[model samples]
Target: MAEERQRIRVEFAYDGGPYHGWAKQPGLPTVQAALEDALAMIIRQPIATVVAGRTDAGVHANQQVVHADIPADIWATVPRNAPLAPAPAMLRRLNGVLAKDHPGIIVHQIQEVPRVFDARFSAVRREYSYQIADGLARWNPLYRHIRWQHREELNVEHMNIGAQDLLGLHDFLSFCRPRPHSTTIRTLEELSFSRLPDGAIKARIIADAFCHNMVRALIAACVQVGAGQRPPAWLGERLAAAERTSETKLAPAHGLVLEKVSYPSCEQWAARAEQTRARRDS
Candidate 1:
């Protein structure tokens, strides 16, 4: 009999310090490779996964979503009538194996979904936050992996002002690493900065999708403003310039976190995926 298949959505968290990135690569550690290997061992079949956000090396995620098609036979092993939901059982099994085999990753969510659920394309928006501690008050060595410790004096007010102009839909080519055959236009929904209780400055950015290095470049531009090297209007002018320039640097990847990915209701997942895959001009 042909193998039966059921689509499953999985959410997990990772430190990203011990692996390359979310994508699998030869001769290097990756989140996907580890998860796929564990799932294949449990299910007795090779498995592949699609992620909601493909984070860069050294980037962390509090809740990263993934989707995979598992063999129905393997999924049936979990108790269905013993008062344990298959979803939670699978979550536990996955986490159990992950904790034993992978030292830095954890699986948190798993649910059977309609076959139309595409983790990447179905996502409506993704939120990213960057932490920087220029004031020294929030620069703690304990969180060296999660936070950026910038010793420079940063004007938070100017950084916030510079970020405000980035709001709305625009072709953000000037801030993205160029990719062939990929459009640089994006709907930048939010870019706000606030002083945390720890005295660190954090930037929260939400967007439909981001081109490679877009967030870091935007942060670098804001940092320049915060450091008094650039004016508020300079960033807007760069947006209009529409070309990636050396003026904006790429912030360290370690400071960025994939906070979350929003999606439409389960009933509309297929439709939402379809809408996301369509090309955009505005």
Candidate 2:
């Protein structure tokens, strides 16, 4: 008989500057490759992980989620030395292995989860934040990797006004990079802008799921409105068009961060995953 398996849920964060992206790619360093390699080293077997959200290159993740399945017996052996539990042992061991090479990625938490818990389909919402240092005064070399340096000062009020029109369920094809067999229809739960104490403008975006380039493109369009280059109503018009336009540019990926991914209670995991899968398939 095949060995019984256990599903593990992992919560982690990474600085995406050093990696290609979250997905593993041939001959290129990626967050997934680094993570899987570390996990394999500890487990003494190859391991694959499914991420909650696949971020683009240069996009950081403050809190990313993933789930993996491994042999239950092997998992029990993780805490070989100290009195630590398997989950904590795996966390320390993986971080130790990663620190030797991939220090930018950190595993914050790990636990055995129900088989029904899927990192991707079980997720109810994903939150992202973008930072912009508009004007020279707000620019800081220390945060260059995390914040976008914009030439023009942005009007937070205008950005908020423009963002309101993009909220709710709609086809965001104009903002998303087209992908085969993927849907651009998304429910944007929240989109708002505010200025930080340090004078940097921050954008918070929450959605059920995002298509490729959707968040950055939305940022670019709203920034134009904030900078007075486009009228606030132009954002609504773009959504109505349902097609990509040259005017809608993609913001730099570095400014975007995946802040959180929320899931329902354990009992609801299976139902949520099934619902999401059915929606995607339809």
Candidate 3:
């Protein structure tokens, strides 16, 4: 038998404010719907997509990768009647359709990857950046889609110290939105804060995987600590409790952006990735 044709991987970026979320819905606009529609037009088939992260509505993605399995024989049929090649041109074409079909969404890039590569499971680390514009005049019109405007003075030093507590493996129940029968264990590789010259603060978080609303809530908790509303050790205590509580507020999704996703370097972790997928499906 011939070797199975691998799934074609596609990376795209989008402003998630208009769509309900990443998943497809009955009557609501979604990123999945927009992409699937564009894929159907491009490949002339019923295409299904698996995303790296299912970002909440109003969240943004600087880099979101997805995979779709298309037939090897179908490559010849792709509309090559454009200036750019099939993959790149498809992005342009998809953007055009998005401009007409799904407003306020764009496909940045598309590429092919190995068959075993899974967009979600293959990811080893996912990075998210949240921007806060503090004491700002005219905020970045370009960054408005992916930033939160907080005029209040923030103690960046305090926030940095609090963020350091979040590093390493922990049961992040406090930061995560509770899910019935779901494990909240995650390994946070990095959590750091940076102060920009324009008086904006940027919070960057890297994790193997994130539970629902974890990053936003983490930022909220850190912000509270920075503002003196909560003590710096409060997050550490909350993590120790492993109790799911709403005491921590979830920051607005507009400020969050999916920055990048790093995949596993070895095959040993494939089993864990597979298990993660199975758990998500279940």
In order, candidate lDDTs are 0.87, 0.94, 0.80
Name the lDDT of candidate 2: 0.94
Clashes of 1: 0
Across 1-282, the per-residue lDDT of candidate 1 in tens digits comes to 777788999988888888888889999998999999988877777899999978889898898999999878768876545567777887877787888869689887898998999999899899999998885666899878877788787998988888888889999998988677778888999998888887888999999989888998999899989989989888899999998766768888899999998998988888888787776322
- Candidate 2 local lDDT, 25-91, one digit each (tens): 9999999999999999988889999999999999999999999999998998999987999999999
Lowest-sum lDDT 10-residue window in model 1 = 273-282
| lDDT score, candidate 1, position 19 | 81
Sort every candidate by lDDT, greatest first: 2, 1, 3
The TM-score that candidate 2 achieves is: 0.98
Model 1 score (lDDT)? 0.87
What are the TM-scores, per candidate, against the unseen true structure?
0.94, 0.98, 0.87
Q: Look at candidate 1 and tell me the lDDT of residue 74.
A: 68
lDDT of 3 at 204: 89
Candidate that scores best on TM-score: 2
Which parts of model 2 are misplaced by more than 4 Å? none
